[model samples]
Structure formats: C-alpha cells, structure tokens
Target: MTPGRLLVTGAAGFIGFHLCRRLLAEGWTVRGIDNLNDYYDPALKRARLSQLEGHPAFTFQHLDIAQRDDLHRLFTGSRFDVVVNLAAQAGVRYSLEHPHSYADSNLLGFVNLLEGCRHQGVDHLLFASSSSVYGANSRLPYSEHDPVDHPVSLYAATKRAGELMAHSYAHLYDIPVTGLRFFTVYGPWGRPDMAYFSFTRKILAGESIPVFNHGQMQRDFTYIDDIVEAVVRLVDHPPQRQVDWPADPATSAAPFRIYNIGNHQPVALLDFIATLEECLGRKAQLELLPMQAGDVLATYAEVNDLAALVDFAPRTPLARGLAEFVRWYRQYYGTA
Candidate 1:
C-alpha cells in the first residue's frame, strides 16, 4: 500500500521536512514544494532541504502555493497520488502585523492546493490544520465533534477555513481528504517562532525569555517523530464515506474527515519551560507578559478517532521531545 507518488507542500518546513524524510525511507517517490519565504531564517530551511538533497526518491521544487500558475504547473506535470499541503504563513501573532500574508498563504494558497487536487485526480489529500482552531473554547480535550466556529486569531480562522475548503472539494469531487489538527508540534528542525525553540535559544544565550500569559498556558506538546508516524500511517489509509456519520453539524456526507493529532496529556507552560531548563542545564531569565493577541490560553487534543483508524497515537513526553530538540539546537547553532 505504498503511495505511488507523493507531493508535500511546505517541504522545507518543520513538520514537512520530517514527513518527506519518512516517506523517502518508506520507498516512495516524493516531490516537495516550498516558497522558502523569509518568515524566519531561510538558512534553517535550506539546512533541512540539504538532508533530502541527494535522496534518489526525493525531488524539490521552489514554488509558492499561492501562485496559481506555478501550482497548476507542478500538479499537471506530476501525477501525485497523495498531496500533503503544509505550506502556510504560520505564526499566530505575526498575523497581526501581516494580515495579507495569512490571506495569501493560508487562504488563497489552500484554495490553489485544493484546485490542484480536484483537477489533477489526486487520490488522498492530507493538509495541515492547527489546534488553534479550537480558539476561545475552554474544553479540557478538544475533539472533532466540538464546534470550532469561534476562532480568536486570523491564523486560526484561516486554518478552520482550510478544513471547510477541503470539505467542499471532497464533497464535490469525491477526493479523499483528511485534515489533521496538529497540537503544539515541536522537535528538531522546528520553527524558530515557536516558544520551545526560542526558549532554548534565549536560555543558552543568558537572555530574558518572555513567559506569555504569565506562564499560565497549557499545551498538548506533540513530538515530531510521533507526528510523522501518524501522518505516514494515514498516507496509506485515506478517508472513507462514514456510513453512519451522525446527522449532526459536525458530520458531513463528503468523503472528508478531520482528526486531532496530539499528545493527550496537556503540560503547563511553566512545566514546559522547566523541562527546557532541565534539558539545557541553564536557567531562563523569565519576563512574564500578558497573553498576546491571536494566542490561545491552552490546547489539548482528543485523538481517539486517529487511534481507531490507524492504531497510532502520539506518546512522546515533553521532556524527551525537548531534550532531542535541545540536542539538535545546540549542534545546529554551535551553542555550547
């Protein structure tokens, strides 16, 4: 049940890089696309790309998903069996400064991906949706059954929009689509804008790190390996028409499904920071700050559906994941 040919958007990104590596290892011909924007350090993106440069099964394309011409050309040229769209303008707070970036990458870019899949006869379409879609909801464990119409940030709104867009495509074209709501994903080759990565950098530099929401936040911090494992399993198993899907608001007639992929255990921000300090053996100078706009107070996922479908679950603890990240960070950046 190997995917014949897989196209992964955002191939240079944190999660995308891991997914590409895993697919290549599983003996799949993988084509990756990325705009390689300067949202953060493009050098880190290049370093991740370097890992897959020489792989026989791997091919790289520099294209932005928002550009309809480039996207159409890529899809029409390559007959992709599975198209995983992970490329987007990815920061929550940054959406405030650059609202159009979100509209372009998350909104228009997603539409382009869907169009490509719809016209190109793509078999399975797996795209990155964020747990941030559970915004303004205080539920202990966020589930696919929960109503997520109240998104707090533009970023969350766009991701939720993506789920809807995927649904429309699935319903209209019978495209098998699976939307993954990733919860606090972190590990090696992670985004610098993420708190865990930034904290590691600042802690080692002996600089003051901002503890947002006065360090009262909690997150279901999922590790990268666990995430990639779930994604790979899903690549072979596309969504089917849920025959008994309830006539409720959440369930639809489309060949579409959404699943939460996260460590079920929610760890507090303070505890996460403590784990980072322990891993790095350095104390972080803390600067407690109010909650930033577009930031949720906490996120905890309910991945029971994912388990039932794939017999897989994210089980990496914060300590182990952060330790691995710290090790990579130190080695990558020459931080002692």
Candidate 2:
C-alpha cells in the first residue's frame, strides 16, 4: 500500500531521521541515503539507522552526494517520485571553522542533487533551508516575502544559495521544488550540538553552561513532530507556478516556493533555560558571554503562507516540548 518511492538524503540526520520514520509509517517505499560523516557522533547516527533497519519498505545507501559519479549512478538506477535533500554540513560556528566543508557538502552536494532530480524526472524536490538566511533583518517575525540578500554566516549563505540554486533548476527543468526554512528545531533524539541538548548535559553534570549574547537571544523553537507534520502535508502540495506570478523573489514563474516551518512563538533565552531547568529538575550555572561570530540575536518565523497553504501550523508549546526532550535525554543517558 505504498504511495510512491521517495529518496531522502541525510536520512540518518536529526530531521531526516524523524521524517524517514514518518514516511515509512505512512507505507511509503523510502530510499534513505547518507554519507554517515562524523559531524557529531557517528554512533548516534548508527543508532537511528538501527531503528529503521528492519523496516520492509526502507533501503539504506552509504554514499556522499558530493561524489558526482556515485550520485549519478544512484539517480540513473532508481526512479524516485520525490527527492528530499536534507543532507548538509550544519552549524553556524562550525561553518566558520570549516568553510570548505560547507562549500563541499552544502554547495557542491546540492548541485549534484539538482542534477539527479533533473535526470530522474523527480515529481518534487523538497529541501531543508534555514531561518538563519534572514540575516541582519530587524523584523520581528521573518517572512518568505522578505528579502534575504545578506547572510551573516557561511552556513546561512549556503542555505540561501540552495534556494537560489533550486529556483534556477525549477525554471530550467520545470522541476517542482519546495524549500523549508526550519527555525530552531528541537526535540527527542536531537543533535547534541544544539544548545538545549548540550545545556541539559552540562546541567546534569553540575557544569557551567555558556549563555551567549548576555542571555538576550530568542528563538522560534519548533518541535520535531510539528516539523514532520508540516513536511508530510506539503509533500502532497507541490508548488505550482501562479498564473499572475509577480516579479517577486519569494516565488517565481517556475514551480518553486519557500516556506518558513516554525512555531511562530519566539521564546527568550532566559525563559527557555528556566523551562529546561523545570524539565530536568535542576538549575544551570550560567556563564554569560558576548555573542559569537555568525550568531543572531533572535529568530521568529512568520508562517502565514505555510498555514494558508497547508491549513496547519506548528503549535507545540516550549514547556511541553522541553519536557519530552528531557525525558528522552535522561532515559537515553541513564541519568533519570
């Protein structure tokens, strides 16, 4: 009872892992590919893969998208209906340290994906963009309609580059494409590099946690389930070129669109830490620090277009999501 075969790059990643599980549950034949790079912990990535190993409709492939030959071979053999490109070297500070990595994976790898989708004639291609693309904007809630010309970080620049790249392919090849601008996504089985996850670990170990920007930061923290729900809904609703397509950067005459998938609520850094403390039943020792390079003061998403299109929006409260994450953290680490 499978709907169609779909290819999800970075299938072992945090968001990709959750998306793969959801797609498999819905009885879709999923071809999950990942390079399994040691970006954080390969062990954690393998653990996620272990959960999907026995699924009847899931197949795992170990290959780097940056490797042109392997990627071409994959697209030549498999006739996929949709391709979700979530594979990228993620992290703002890390991007500063590893600019070449971002160029290799986020830039070159994405071109390979576009080429694959073009040749394979993929019905739709959904990719993971970042809210960080709204760089240097003083606006309260970032919107798709806003201009995203200035990117403060290499990571954000690459993500914005991906959007432009995808738009070009859609215009040239008429491939239907959607770019999701995810904001501060967090939940169970999340990346350890994320502040919440690392903060939990440090708090449990009675260590000091670094509070950046003098604890003035805010984020539109979206739950993993909410993200999965939004993505699932949009999969059935590929972007169609509008009859009266304006000369706008947000959309195009091509079948391409971008949506900010996030909880519109922006929580302050101190309040978020308080919620985490309540969840873990422990207070954190904070070391206030200046804002790091390639860091933003806040991120709030304007999801009106997403709501209008999907008839849904992310509604998970921060307290509940943090509680769930804490529960999983303690159990996963045997610290409960």
Candidate 3:
C-alpha cells in the first residue's frame, strides 16, 4: 500500500511539513506544493523547508492552490497516488478582515484540488477540516455525527463547505475522500498566531499575554506528532462504501468519511498557560480580554471513530508537548 508519489499541498505549513517528512522516511517519493504566502512569517516556512531541502525523495513547488492553471499543471505532471490538501487561508479572525482570501484559497483552490484528483485518478484524497466548524454548539464532545450547520466564523463555514464539497466529489466521481476535523492542534514548529506560541514569545520578552474569553475557554490541544501519526495511518486506509449507512440524516451514502483527530481531553486555557509557564520556567503576565468575534468558547473532539478505524489515537499530554515546543522555540530563536 505504499504510495508511489504523494502530493502534499501546503508543504511548508506546520502539519504539511511533518506529513511530508514522515512519508519520505517511509521510502515514498513526496512532491510538495506551497505558495510561501506571508500569512504569518514566510521565514518560518522557509526554515521548515530547509529541514527537507536535502532529501532526495522530496521535491517542492512554489505554487498557490488558488492558481488553478498552475495547480492543474502540477496535478497533470505528478499524477500522484495520494493527495493531502493542507493549504488554506487559515485564521478565524483574519477571515473577517479579508474574506476574499478564504474564498479564493479554501473554496476555489479546494475545488481545483478535487478536480485534479478526479481527473488524475488519485487513490485517496485527504484534506484538513477544522474543529471551528463545530461552532456555536454546546455539545460536550463534537462527533462526526453531530450537525455542523451552524458555523460561527467565515473560516469555519469554509471548512464545512470544503467537507461538503469533498463529499460531492466523492459521490459523483467515486473518489475516496477523508475529511479530518482537527481540534486545537499545537506543538513544536507551530503557527505563531496560535496562543501557545505567542504566549511563549511574549512571556520570554516580559510582555503581557492576552487571555481570550476572559480565560474561560477550553480546547482539545493535540500534539503535532500524534496528528501526523493519525494521518499516516489513515493514508493507507481509504473510506469504503457504507453499505448500511443510516437514513436518519446523520450518515452519508458517498465514499466519503469525516473523523475527529484530537486528544479527546479538553484542557482549560488557564491550565494550558500554567503548563507553558512550567515548561518555559517563566510566569506569564496575563491580560484578560473578552471573546472576539468569530471565536468559540470551547472545543472538545470525540475521536472514538478514529481510534476504532485506525487503532491509534492522539495521546500526548499538553505538559509534555509544550515542553517539546518550548525546547524547539528556545533552540530556534536562541532565546534561552
């Protein structure tokens, strides 16, 4: 079940980089695509790319998924066995400022990927969805069976849209598709916009860290390694025809499936900060702020289906994962 050539979009991104490295380690030829956009810091993305620069099995292309022609060219050229679409205009608040960016990348770009997979005869197509799609739902632990019709933010809406779009493609074209609902993914080489990374930077600089939602938020913070592990396992196992898919409106008939990949343990925001402080050996100056627009109060993922299907689950504790992240941060930035 080895992939001859794997195409990973957003290779320079946090998750994409890890997935590509893992694939290469497993003796697979990996082709990566990314625009190197200045979403946060292109330098960080470059640093991530530098880790895979010398790998003979890895090839990278600097192209945005929004560019349909360029993406079509790559698809036509590579004819990948597996396609993992991680490239997206990612941010809840940023979506409010630049809504068009989300439309271009998350919507148009995603359709282009589906088209490429459909035409190229890709075996398995995996794409990143978000826990944010569970918006405004007070459900204790969000499940694949739960209704995601009420998305609070534009970003969440787009992610939900991507899931539906993937389902449509899977049904019409018979492409095997899996949509992953990631819940508060964080670890080493993480996004700077994430609170854990920013808190470490501010704390080191003796600055105040903003605690959103007046520090009442909780999240199922999953580690990066665990995420990559789940993805790699799922790569070998594509969705099959659900012969007994319920007609109760909760299940679908397509060769498409969605799973929640998370730690399944929601940690309070204040407790997570405490873990960070312990990891970095510094106390953070906290400034409590009201919840911003397009923000959720909490996110808890129910990953039972993932565990049952893949026989593996994300188990990294926040304390351990943050310690690894702090170590990487200190070494990368020369802060310690």
Highest lDDT against the true fold, candidate: 2
Across 1-336, the per-residue lDDT of candidate 2 in tens digits comes to: 127999999999999999999999988899999999998999889889998989999999998999999999999988999889999999999998889999999999999999999988888899999999999988888989989999999999999999999999999999999999999999998999999999999999999999999999998999999999999988998888888998776788999999999999999999999999999899999999999999999999999998998897777899999999999888878996
Question: lDDT ranking from best to worst?
Answer: 2, 3, 1
Q: 1-336 in candidate 3: lDDT tens per residue?
A: 765889999999999999999999988899999999998999999999999979999999899998899988887777788889999999999999999999999999999999999998789999999999989888889888888899999999999999989999998998999998888888878999998999999999999999988899998999999999999999988887687788522246778889889999999999999999999899999999999999988889898888888897777878899999999999999996
Please state the error at residue 276 of candidate 3 in Å.
0.5
TM-score of each: 0.98, 0.98, 0.98
Model 1 clash pairs are none
C-alpha lDDT score of every prediction, in listed order: 0.90, 0.93, 0.90
Candidate 1, residues 44-115: lDDT per residue as tens digits? Answer: 999999999899999999999999999999878889888999999898989988999999999999999999
User: Model 1's lDDT to the true fold?
Assistant: 0.90
On lDDT, the stronger of 2 and 3 is 2
After superposition, candidate 3 runs with Cα above 4 Å error: 248-251
